[model samples]
Target chain A: ETAVFQTPNYHVTQVGNEVSFNCKQTLGHDTMYWYKQDSKKLLKIMFSYNNKQLIVNETVPRRFSPQSSDKAHLNLRIKSVEPEDSAVYLCASSFLGGRATGQLYFGEGSKLTVL
Target chain B: QQQVRQSPQSLTVWEGETAILNCSYEDSTFDYFPWYWQFPRESPALLIAIRPVSNKKEDGRFTIFFNKREKKLSLHITDSQPGDSATYFCAASNNRIFFGDGTQLVVKP
Candidate 1:
């Protein structure tokens, strides 16, 4: 019953390497998001896209960037990975202003391990 | 500033007992509240939700009690079971969503 999907369930890379995580949602949602969860289980929002338009960008590092091709596909690319970037990157989707509002459907998450 | 906040970073409860998870938010503009649960090694999914218009929302054994005046909410899980053990997240939304650090719940049988 998962409508949101993520690639590279687990990736291990060294510092200064580039990593890209892809996400797609088939729920016809108008919004998508990327969240980083650290080992402490703290979930922090990185970016949010509404209909392929960048809407919310938290205080993430410049090395981290988000891309959106359409309303269904959103991707995260880290230009230069760091030790602090080793965490689970979760992708989620939701609809705005309706019965389904405020409910988020999340993917399995892409776990990044920086060496 | 952290808009949404959850209490008891971790909790342990006996089976068949009622487990209460508390949440509060700083933004009065937030109108939607949803509680999501995540099991180990799995992604989070919506467990229950409530809006400011209603003070309570219930579904089976899961119930959400909301307080618009104090901007606080609580999720009560009754008849707790081992399978109910997971991390519960409280979130507030106003077009943009904000999630609180989850409360890890452990139900002992």
Candidate 2:
């Protein structure tokens, strides 16, 4: 059983359009994260949430935002998307707090294409 | 600036040979080091990890050689197989992880 899940496996949108990607984890982990992989395959952290609390926020553009409605769900939204914003976005979860573990379980990524 | 750096953006190794992937970090607070692998059309997953307390960690044929003083670490895949062809990422974590640009490894049979 896959512990982490994501929706909208792929999306193609025009520049300036708004896009949203959804993520959920059934692993009951307290920490969730969003990562961006550019065309060059360079991976970078975008944001992280722990029990719905913002724990780590990278220097991302204002157009990008991470929304976590609960401990098990985290979403990523990009407004006024630019051509350079096209990339594969990955969601991951990890155990924190009392059951702290550094191992991360990642979901199949959402690929975004800006035209 | 990149907190973690990986060299030889790409590597090619013959099957049955040993492959080494290198990594270095700039942060001293990083106590946890983990290596992740992603096959084509697949999401990255945790492959192996190590702590500052140990200089080496081996999982079957995969081993991690860590140098705390140099802020460096490396992953070695022994008896490399075609199935091992993928992108390997090196990362460090305190509370969160900082990943290096992945190294794409290709194994030739």
Candidate 3:
């Protein structure tokens, strides 16, 4: 029943390994975002894409990268996973409007575990 | 560097009571405020939202009280039920949205 779909709901890998997560939205929202929820439950914006164009990219580690092939898809890839990289990565989409406040739609999230 | 903040990291209330959650932001340019709630092992969803033009917005049992002058707002859940227990987040944005530390609410039946 999720409008936003994510694959590999849970993943586990050793340090120095690579990992990837996929996300897709059906709401037709032009803007999508990637947020990381740490152990402390703090949600931080990592990246955002509007119509396949990178708009907001936070000061994330170099190992982390985001790819968007279309407006409905946004993917996250970690080149070299670290122990501290264990967290919930959430994909969200929102309608782009200049006058109105954006309301976000989110996926179930992919939980990453690095050893 | 937290622009939006929420008070009382956690709260508890009885069924049929009103639960209030408070939030404040530092950015005056943030005209839109949206409150989202997430249950355990689930994704967060929008509960209610408001703009600076209006001081209050209500939807069924959920309501958002906004104060543009103080840059503060509160979400009031009337007739709280156990099902209403979840983590509530306050967010603000002009172009892009920023989230606040969620407030965990526990409603006892």
Candidate 4:
């Protein structure tokens, strides 16, 4: 019973190409986050959106952007994908934003490979 | 600087043996500590969590020992089984959850 969902279990693209990953949550959470996991399995928070407001941008490149159509949906778009962008993209959602008390429900993840 | 540091990049234990995964944090303001477990090709899921108010929390075979003074915590898996094999991450947060590099554990049957 996965509350969060991500499309395209895996994607392989070339450098300079634009890519988009879609994420949706049915838990009715107000906060959504995007995290990148490298080959070493280190998870880093890239961006977070609370009530459709952007927060917690961790020095991500301008090419990387997040779009939220509504609170339940947050999408990640890479304008020009680079080889270094090859990693696992995970989407998670939680309730509220002040402090994380409840667990964050995560999607399986979308694997991106840029050659 | 890494906010959280986890030890033994990887660990292996025999079935039925207790396995301990250690973690330390640099942020004193972190009042909440949670441990997440992830399997290959799956997203990390919260296994158990503990607040600084308590020194220990237990759920079934998983337990979290917290040291608020030392800014450290450890996860103890009692009666470890093969199904417990996975990467375990230790996270701390006052506002946002900050995760450690994670420890890959393997339980040999």
Chain A TM-score of each candidate structure, as shown = 0.96, 0.95, 0.95, 0.96
Lowest lDDT 10-residue stretch of candidate 4 chain A: A95-104
Candidate 1, after superposition: displacement of residue B19 in Å? Answer: 0.4
lDDT, candidate 1, A66-111, per-residue tens: 9999999999999999999999999998886223578888999999
- Give the Å shift of residue A48 in candidate 1: 0.7
| lDDT for position A39 in model 1 | 89
TM-score of model 1 vs. true structure: 0.97
Can you write out model 4's per-residue Cα lDDT over B1-109, one digit (the tens) per residue?
9999998799999999999999999988887888999998789999999998899999999999998888889999999999999999998877787899999999999
Query: Candidate 3 - CAPRI tier?
Result: medium
Instruction: State which candidate, 3 or 4, has the greater lDDT.
Output: 4
Local distance difference test scores for all models:
0.92, 0.91, 0.92, 0.92
Error of 3 at A6 (Å): 0.9
CAPRI category for model 2: medium
**TM-score head-to-head 1 vs 3, winner:** 1
Candidate 3 differs from the real structure by a C-alpha RMSD in angstroms, to one decimal, of 1.4
Per-model TM-score versus the true fold: 0.97, 0.96, 0.96, 0.97
Evaluated on CA atoms against the true complex, candidate 3 attains a DockQ of 0.62
TM-score of 4: 0.97
Off by over 4 Å in 3: A97-99
lDDT of 3 by residue, A67-107 (tens): 99999999999999999999999999988732254688899
Order of candidates by DockQ, top first? 4, 1, 3, 2
Best DockQ goes to which candidate? 4
